[model samples]
Target: MPGGDISDLDKNRVLAQWLEWQLRQVRNRIRELEVQELKDKRRAEQARAGQRWKIQPQRSNVAALLHRGDCSLYSSEMGFLDREEAIIALAEPDIEACQICKPETGLVQT
Candidate 1:
Protein backbone atom coordinates (compact mmCIF):
# COMPACT_ATOMS: atom_id res chain seq x y z
CA MET A 1 0.00 0.00 0.00
CA PRO A 2 2.85 2.39 0.80
CA GLY A 3 4.53 1.83 -2.58
CA GLY A 4 1.28 2.30 -4.45
CA ASP A 5 0.66 5.64 -2.73
CA ILE A 6 4.13 6.93 -3.68
CA SER A 7 3.59 6.03 -7.31
CA ASP A 8 0.30 7.89 -7.37
CA LEU A 9 1.96 11.01 -5.92
CA ASP A 10 4.66 10.93 -8.61
CA LYS A 11 2.05 10.64 -11.33
CA ASN A 12 0.13 13.57 -9.91
CA ARG A 13 3.25 15.75 -9.84
CA VAL A 14 4.02 15.02 -13.48
CA LEU A 15 0.45 15.76 -14.49
CA ALA A 16 0.47 19.07 -12.64
CA GLN A 17 3.70 20.16 -14.32
CA TRP A 18 2.33 19.30 -17.75
CA LEU A 19 -0.82 21.26 -17.11
CA GLU A 20 1.14 24.29 -15.98
CA TRP A 21 3.29 24.24 -19.10
CA GLN A 22 0.22 23.97 -21.39
CA LEU A 23 -1.45 26.89 -19.64
CA ARG A 24 1.65 29.05 -20.11
CA GLN A 25 1.74 28.26 -23.80
CA VAL A 26 -1.93 29.22 -24.12
CA ARG A 27 -1.37 32.54 -22.35
CA ASN A 28 1.60 33.37 -24.58
CA ARG A 29 -0.42 32.64 -27.70
CA ILE A 30 -3.21 34.90 -26.49
CA ARG A 31 -0.75 37.73 -25.96
CA GLU A 32 0.68 37.33 -29.45
CA LEU A 33 -2.82 37.37 -30.94
CA GLU A 34 -3.69 40.54 -29.07
CA VAL A 35 -0.64 42.34 -30.41
CA GLN A 36 -1.43 41.26 -33.96
CA GLU A 37 -5.02 42.47 -33.57
CA LEU A 38 -3.87 45.91 -32.49
CA LYS A 39 -1.53 46.15 -35.46
CA ASP A 40 -4.35 45.20 -37.84
CA LYS A 41 -6.63 47.81 -36.35
CA ARG A 42 -4.02 50.53 -36.79
CA ARG A 43 -3.50 49.60 -40.43
CA ALA A 44 -7.23 49.67 -41.05
CA GLU A 45 -7.54 53.10 -39.49
CA GLN A 46 -4.74 54.41 -41.71
CA ALA A 47 -6.46 53.06 -44.78
CA ARG A 48 -9.71 54.72 -43.79
CA ALA A 49 -7.97 58.04 -43.22
CA GLY A 50 -6.37 57.84 -46.66
CA GLN A 51 -9.74 57.19 -48.23
CA ARG A 52 -11.21 60.20 -46.48
CA TRP A 53 -8.45 62.41 -47.86
CA LYS A 54 -9.23 61.14 -51.35
CA ILE A 55 -12.86 62.09 -50.89
CA GLN A 56 -12.06 65.65 -49.85
CA PRO A 57 -9.04 67.52 -51.18
CA GLN A 58 -7.02 70.11 -49.27
CA ARG A 59 -6.84 73.54 -50.92
CA SER A 60 -3.33 74.44 -52.05
CA ASN A 61 -1.75 75.08 -55.44
CA VAL A 62 1.62 73.88 -54.25
CA ALA A 63 -0.11 70.65 -53.33
CA ALA A 64 -1.30 70.34 -56.90
CA LEU A 65 2.13 71.07 -58.34
CA LEU A 66 3.75 68.57 -56.02
CA HIS A 67 1.18 66.06 -57.17
CA ARG A 68 2.55 66.49 -60.69
CA GLY A 69 6.21 66.14 -61.72
CA ASP A 70 6.21 69.17 -64.03
CA CYS A 71 8.10 71.25 -61.48
CA SER A 72 11.24 70.05 -59.69
CA LEU A 73 10.83 72.33 -56.68
CA TYR A 74 10.34 70.68 -53.28
CA SER A 75 10.60 72.10 -49.79
CA SER A 76 13.82 71.14 -48.06
CA GLU A 77 12.95 72.63 -44.66
CA MET A 78 10.46 71.08 -42.27
CA GLY A 79 7.40 73.34 -42.04
CA PHE A 80 4.30 74.20 -43.97
CA LEU A 81 5.17 76.20 -47.09
CA ASP A 82 4.06 79.79 -47.02
CA ARG A 83 0.50 80.06 -48.30
CA GLU A 84 1.45 82.89 -50.65
CA GLU A 85 4.16 80.84 -52.42
CA ALA A 86 1.76 77.93 -52.88
CA ILE A 87 -0.86 80.22 -54.39
CA ILE A 88 1.54 81.87 -56.79
CA ALA A 89 3.05 78.63 -58.06
CA LEU A 90 -0.33 77.03 -58.57
CA ALA A 91 -1.96 80.00 -60.30
CA GLU A 92 0.44 80.11 -63.24
CA PRO A 93 -1.82 80.83 -66.22
CA ASP A 94 0.09 78.93 -68.92
CA ILE A 95 1.18 75.71 -67.19
CA GLU A 96 -1.70 73.47 -68.22
CA ALA A 97 0.41 70.34 -68.54
CA CYS A 98 -0.80 67.16 -66.88
CA GLN A 99 1.58 64.70 -65.25
CA ILE A 100 0.80 61.51 -63.43
CA CYS A 101 2.24 61.37 -59.93
CA LYS A 102 1.18 61.18 -56.32
CA PRO A 103 1.48 64.10 -53.89
CA GLU A 104 3.87 63.46 -51.05
CA THR A 105 4.45 65.97 -48.30
CA GLY A 106 7.31 64.81 -46.09
CA LEU A 107 5.52 65.12 -42.78
CA VAL A 108 2.31 66.22 -41.15
CA GLN A 109 2.29 69.50 -39.26
CA THR A 110 -0.08 70.63 -36.52
Candidate 2:
Protein backbone atom coordinates (compact mmCIF):
# COMPACT_ATOMS: atom_id res chain seq x y z
CA MET A 1 0.00 0.00 0.00
CA PRO A 2 3.04 2.31 0.52
CA GLY A 3 3.95 1.89 -3.16
CA GLY A 4 0.42 2.82 -4.17
CA ASP A 5 0.62 5.90 -1.94
CA ILE A 6 3.88 6.96 -3.64
CA SER A 7 2.22 6.48 -7.06
CA ASP A 8 -0.65 8.77 -6.03
CA LEU A 9 1.79 11.45 -4.82
CA ASP A 10 3.66 11.33 -8.12
CA LYS A 11 0.45 11.71 -10.14
CA ASN A 12 -0.61 14.67 -8.03
CA ARG A 13 2.74 16.38 -8.55
CA VAL A 14 2.48 15.90 -12.31
CA LEU A 15 -1.04 17.31 -12.28
CA ALA A 16 0.04 20.37 -10.30
CA GLN A 17 2.90 21.04 -12.73
CA TRP A 18 0.57 20.76 -15.73
CA LEU A 19 -1.88 23.19 -14.15
CA GLU A 20 0.91 25.68 -13.41
CA TRP A 21 2.06 25.52 -17.03
CA GLN A 22 -1.45 26.09 -18.25
CA LEU A 23 -1.80 29.10 -15.95
CA ARG A 24 1.43 30.54 -17.29
CA GLN A 25 0.20 30.14 -20.87
CA VAL A 26 -3.04 31.93 -20.02
CA ARG A 27 -1.19 34.78 -18.30
CA ASN A 28 1.13 35.19 -21.29
CA ARG A 29 -1.82 35.30 -23.67
CA ILE A 30 -3.48 37.98 -21.56
CA ARG A 31 -0.38 40.13 -21.72
CA GLU A 32 -0.21 39.75 -25.49
CA LEU A 33 -3.83 40.72 -25.86
CA GLU A 34 -3.32 43.78 -23.67
CA VAL A 35 -0.46 44.93 -25.86
CA GLN A 36 -2.52 44.39 -29.00
CA GLU A 37 -5.40 46.36 -27.55
CA LEU A 38 -3.15 49.28 -26.67
CA LYS A 39 -1.68 49.34 -30.16
CA ASP A 40 -5.11 49.33 -31.73
CA LYS A 41 -6.23 52.19 -29.51
CA ARG A 42 -3.25 54.30 -30.47
CA ARG A 43 -3.85 53.59 -34.15
CA ALA A 44 -7.43 54.72 -33.84
CA GLU A 45 -6.39 57.94 -32.13
CA GLN A 46 -3.91 58.72 -34.88
CA ALA A 47 -6.52 58.09 -37.53
CA ARG A 48 -8.85 60.56 -35.87
CA ALA A 49 -6.09 63.09 -35.43
CA GLY A 50 -5.00 63.21 -39.08
CA GLN A 51 -8.35 62.79 -40.77
CA ARG A 52 -9.68 66.36 -40.47
CA TRP A 53 -9.44 69.92 -39.05
CA LYS A 54 -11.74 72.02 -36.89
CA ILE A 55 -12.46 75.72 -36.47
CA GLN A 56 -13.67 77.76 -33.56
CA PRO A 57 -15.87 80.61 -34.74
CA GLN A 58 -15.21 84.16 -33.63
CA ARG A 59 -16.23 84.89 -30.07
CA SER A 60 -17.07 88.25 -28.49
CA ASN A 61 -13.65 89.85 -28.97
CA VAL A 62 -11.58 86.90 -30.15
CA ALA A 63 -10.82 85.98 -33.70
CA ALA A 64 -11.85 82.63 -35.09
CA LEU A 65 -9.31 79.88 -34.43
CA LEU A 66 -8.10 77.04 -36.59
CA HIS A 67 -6.96 73.81 -35.02
CA ARG A 68 -5.56 70.47 -36.00
CA GLY A 69 -7.91 67.57 -35.60
CA ASP A 70 -6.02 66.45 -32.52
CA CYS A 71 -5.54 69.87 -30.95
CA SER A 72 -6.59 70.16 -27.33
CA LEU A 73 -6.66 73.95 -27.10
CA TYR A 74 -10.05 74.36 -28.75
CA SER A 75 -12.62 71.71 -29.48
CA SER A 76 -15.31 72.33 -32.09
CA GLU A 77 -18.23 69.95 -32.23
CA MET A 78 -19.23 71.32 -35.60
CA GLY A 79 -18.26 69.64 -38.83
CA PHE A 80 -14.55 69.21 -39.52
CA LEU A 81 -12.77 70.97 -42.38
CA ASP A 82 -10.96 69.26 -45.21
CA ARG A 83 -7.52 70.34 -46.49
CA GLU A 84 -8.91 72.75 -49.05
CA GLU A 85 -11.35 74.13 -46.54
CA ALA A 86 -8.54 74.62 -44.05
CA ILE A 87 -6.50 76.46 -46.62
CA ILE A 88 -9.40 78.75 -47.32
CA ALA A 89 -10.03 79.29 -43.64
CA LEU A 90 -6.45 80.36 -43.15
CA ALA A 91 -6.90 82.94 -45.86
CA GLU A 92 -9.75 84.61 -43.96
CA PRO A 93 -8.92 87.94 -42.29
CA ASP A 94 -10.41 87.00 -38.91
CA ILE A 95 -9.34 83.32 -38.75
CA GLU A 96 -5.98 82.53 -37.23
CA ALA A 97 -4.16 79.19 -36.92
CA CYS A 98 -3.74 77.84 -33.41
CA GLN A 99 -0.29 78.62 -32.04
CA ILE A 100 -0.15 75.40 -30.07
CA CYS A 101 -1.07 73.10 -32.98
CA LYS A 102 0.16 75.29 -35.89
CA PRO A 103 -2.67 74.15 -38.14
CA GLU A 104 -1.25 76.18 -41.00
CA THR A 105 2.22 74.61 -40.97
CA GLY A 106 1.47 72.36 -43.89
CA LEU A 107 -1.39 74.25 -45.48
CA VAL A 108 0.01 77.74 -45.90
CA GLN A 109 1.53 78.76 -49.20
CA THR A 110 5.24 79.53 -48.98
Candidate 3:
Protein backbone atom coordinates (compact mmCIF):
# COMPACT_ATOMS: atom_id res chain seq x y z
CA MET A 1 0.00 0.00 0.00
CA PRO A 2 2.92 2.37 0.54
CA GLY A 3 4.90 3.53 -2.65
CA GLY A 4 2.08 2.63 -5.13
CA ASP A 5 0.41 -0.80 -5.58
CA ILE A 6 2.58 -3.47 -7.20
CA SER A 7 1.13 -6.56 -8.98
CA ASP A 8 1.82 -9.96 -7.39
CA LEU A 9 3.19 -11.15 -10.81
CA ASP A 10 5.77 -8.32 -10.84
CA LYS A 11 6.91 -9.16 -7.30
CA ASN A 12 7.24 -12.82 -8.24
CA ARG A 13 9.27 -11.89 -11.34
CA VAL A 14 11.62 -9.70 -9.32
CA LEU A 15 12.03 -12.46 -6.73
CA ALA A 16 12.81 -15.01 -9.43
CA GLN A 17 15.44 -12.75 -10.96
CA TRP A 18 17.11 -12.24 -7.58
CA LEU A 19 17.12 -15.99 -6.94
CA GLU A 20 18.68 -16.63 -10.36
CA TRP A 21 21.43 -14.08 -9.67
CA GLN A 22 22.16 -15.74 -6.33
CA LEU A 23 22.28 -19.15 -7.96
CA ARG A 24 24.76 -17.92 -10.58
CA GLN A 25 27.00 -16.48 -7.89
CA VAL A 26 26.93 -19.76 -5.98
CA ARG A 27 27.78 -21.73 -9.12
CA ASN A 28 30.65 -19.39 -9.95
CA ARG A 29 32.06 -19.80 -6.45
CA ILE A 30 31.78 -23.58 -6.74
CA ARG A 31 33.71 -23.47 -10.02
CA GLU A 32 36.44 -21.31 -8.49
CA LEU A 33 36.75 -23.66 -5.52
CA GLU A 34 36.95 -26.65 -7.83
CA VAL A 35 39.78 -25.01 -9.76
CA GLN A 36 41.64 -24.29 -6.54
CA GLU A 37 41.14 -27.87 -5.38
CA LEU A 38 42.59 -29.20 -8.63
CA LYS A 39 45.63 -26.96 -8.26
CA ASP A 40 46.21 -28.12 -4.69
CA LYS A 41 45.91 -31.74 -5.75
CA ARG A 42 48.45 -31.25 -8.56
CA ARG A 43 50.90 -29.51 -6.23
CA ALA A 44 50.59 -32.29 -3.71
CA GLU A 45 51.23 -34.85 -6.42
CA GLN A 46 54.35 -32.99 -7.56
CA ALA A 47 55.67 -32.85 -4.00
CA ARG A 48 55.18 -36.57 -3.60
CA ALA A 49 56.83 -37.17 -6.92
CA GLY A 50 59.83 -35.15 -5.88
CA GLN A 51 60.44 -37.44 -2.90
CA ARG A 52 60.43 -40.59 -5.03
CA TRP A 53 61.98 -42.06 -8.18
CA LYS A 54 60.86 -43.97 -11.23
CA ILE A 55 62.30 -46.34 -13.84
CA GLN A 56 61.45 -46.30 -17.50
CA PRO A 57 61.72 -49.72 -19.03
CA GLN A 58 64.28 -50.25 -21.74
CA ARG A 59 62.96 -49.58 -25.23
CA SER A 60 64.50 -51.38 -28.22
CA ASN A 61 68.18 -51.98 -27.42
CA VAL A 62 68.44 -49.07 -24.98
CA ALA A 63 68.93 -49.87 -21.32
CA ALA A 64 66.31 -49.04 -18.71
CA LEU A 65 66.50 -45.42 -17.69
CA LEU A 66 66.30 -44.14 -14.12
CA HIS A 67 64.69 -40.78 -13.56
CA ARG A 68 63.59 -38.44 -10.82
CA GLY A 69 59.92 -39.01 -10.09
CA ASP A 70 59.14 -35.48 -11.25
CA CYS A 71 60.79 -36.01 -14.62
CA SER A 72 58.43 -35.33 -17.49
CA LEU A 73 60.52 -37.04 -20.17
CA TYR A 74 59.12 -40.40 -19.13
CA SER A 75 55.72 -40.93 -17.60
CA SER A 76 55.14 -44.17 -15.75
CA GLU A 77 51.87 -45.10 -14.07
CA MET A 78 53.80 -47.77 -12.19
CA GLY A 79 54.77 -47.42 -8.55
CA PHE A 80 57.75 -45.24 -7.65
CA LEU A 81 61.01 -46.36 -6.04
CA ASP A 82 62.28 -45.09 -2.69
CA ARG A 83 65.70 -43.47 -2.18
CA GLU A 84 67.41 -46.74 -1.31
CA GLU A 85 65.57 -48.46 -4.10
CA ALA A 86 66.78 -45.81 -6.54
CA ILE A 87 70.36 -46.39 -5.44
CA ILE A 88 69.89 -50.10 -5.91
CA ALA A 89 68.41 -49.54 -9.34
CA LEU A 90 71.34 -47.37 -10.28
CA ALA A 91 73.64 -50.20 -9.27
CA GLU A 92 72.08 -52.40 -11.93
CA PRO A 93 74.31 -52.57 -14.99
CA ASP A 94 71.28 -52.50 -17.31
CA ILE A 95 69.79 -49.39 -15.75
CA GLU A 96 71.07 -45.99 -16.86
CA ALA A 97 70.49 -42.66 -15.20
CA CYS A 98 68.47 -40.09 -17.11
CA GLN A 99 70.72 -37.49 -18.72
CA ILE A 100 68.10 -34.80 -18.34
CA CYS A 101 67.03 -35.17 -14.69
CA LYS A 102 70.28 -36.92 -13.65
CA PRO A 103 68.60 -39.04 -10.98
CA GLU A 104 72.02 -40.34 -9.81
CA THR A 105 72.92 -36.84 -8.59
CA GLY A 106 70.54 -37.27 -5.65
CA LEU A 107 72.15 -40.49 -4.49
CA VAL A 108 75.39 -40.95 -2.60
CA GLN A 109 77.76 -43.58 -3.89
CA THR A 110 79.05 -46.00 -1.28
Against the reference, the lDDT scores of all candidates come to 0.46, 0.87, 0.92
Ten residues in sequence with the least summed lDDT for candidate 3: 101-110
- Which digits, one per residue and each the tens of the lDDT, describe model 3 over residues 28-57? 999999999999999999999888899999
lDDT of 2 by residue, 12-47 (tens): 999999999999999999999999999999889868
RMSD of each: 10.2, 3.1, 2.2
Off by over 4 Å in 3: 1-3
Which of candidates 1 and 3 is the stronger one according to lDDT? Answer: 3
TM-score winner: 3
Candidate 1 — which residues are off by over 4 angstroms? 1-6, 54-110
The TM-scores of all predictions, comma-separated, are: 0.45, 0.70, 0.85
Ten contiguous residues with the weakest lDDT in model 1: 49-58
Weakest lDDT window of 10 consecutive positions for candidate 2:
1-10
Report the Cα lDDT for residue 12, model 2. 93
Clashes of each: 0, 0, 0
Clashing pairs in 3: none
